[model samples]
Target: MDTNVITPEGYAELQQELDTLWRHERPEVTRKVQWAASLGDRSENADYQYNKKRLREIDRRVRFLRNRLSKLRVVEYNPVQEGKAYFGAWVTLVDEDDQTLTFRIVGPDEIYGKQHYVSVHAPVVKACLGKAEGDEVRVRTPDSVKLWEIAEIRYGLAAADR
Candidate 1:
């Protein structure tokens, strides 16, 4: 099962998408479908067929977003999480070669379509949890063990500075 937790910002983003699709795009597409259907002979009318298909897709996405929003639990940043890796943290890691990688640890649902956002369940994330800056994490990949050091950890609005 996908994790039910989401950062406050991630929750707002999902809510905004739902609002745009439902209140704006859905109405616009519905109008197109109605106008096309009025032309009659839907089987032969390309506009009608295409709009009908688009409407179904919109409806399916709306249903999913609504259900997901209802079930998600927003996780806000806490002062206690300072100086440690945790959910909603922006972590910068340095490998043995001094190659650096940066990403935010978020829920599985929130990671979709986002750049540099890793799922909380990801192996690298699991290995880094509770680790402080300068601590080494041995992440076990399918190929081999990779060592990474925590270069930095930032949370909440501080993360936006990057």
Candidate 2:
């Protein structure tokens, strides 16, 4: 399987979530399952049935997270990537309608809960790769091709300053 790319912050967040699930949530749920089981007649026990299902779901998620984290490569900000659109770059673009959109190019895992974060594999990012400020890019959508101009590009501390 291909390794997934993740930002340093995103990597840490995943690790913390894995630790919490393994050390805290799993144990608490396991205790509930045990308590429910001790009441006997598990086939008719609502608590037992519920907890058993919940435990399976939790374990599945834990396994998936562990495997995903193991295969992820945490990408840190690089000064060498300055002035061009790349992973972890904050980019501003002007669309054909003359409207401006600003977003950060990040990994697939980092886009959750962040409206302004675009995945590196997204068509817009693919079109913008290796493009510097003032460069034009073409994005092909299902309906038509759209034109966008790179208004600005920055990385690391410089990106935060903007």
Candidate 3:
């Protein structure tokens, strides 16, 4: 559960977001705030208040993205990790009830908007780490312990292949 580890694609995505917020979005909000402020009425100006709040939010996100991008380590796929459940692995597991769940193991930051992604810090992912296809994994959650069989383990194409 190394919080600093992120897939190469995840890192690139974060970088792109930072670039967009800094280069495009922030400047637009700043201009809006200035234009709103120029309108005489300060107290009842809805545009000024709203755009000012948006400017603060954008600045906060830009600062956070800058800091997070600096500390993240982009983990590229390694040949040794092929066929094993590791970071950036697409894992499929079947439970005792025969229900199947599939997700890609990624960093905590990358799981926010992705339904098919699970954080490495999650209990299920922790149990599946280093396991191979057809291996049985015991996942202990706050509610109960469950058994899952690894049905498939796949990784994205290697960097060289791309």
Top candidate (TM-score)? 1
Q: How does model 3 fare in lDDT? A: 0.89
lDDT tens string, model 3, 7-82? 9888888999999989998899889888988998968999999989988898899899999989999889999999
Model 1: pairs clashing at backbone N, Cα or C within 3 Å? none
What's every prediction's RMSD, in angstroms?
1.8, 2.7, 3.2
Model 1 residue 42 lDDT?
Answer: 85
* Clashes in predicted model 1: 0
Local distance difference test, candidate 1: 0.91
Query: Candidate 1 deviates by what RMSD?
Result: 1.8
Q: How well does candidate 1 score on lDDT at residue 51?
A: 82
Model 1 stretches with alpha carbons more than 4 Å out:
157-162
Residue 114, candidate 1: C-alpha displacement in angstroms: 1.6
The Cα error of candidate 3 at residue 18, in Å, is 1.0
Pairs clashing in candidate 3? none
Which one wins on lDDT?
Answer: 1
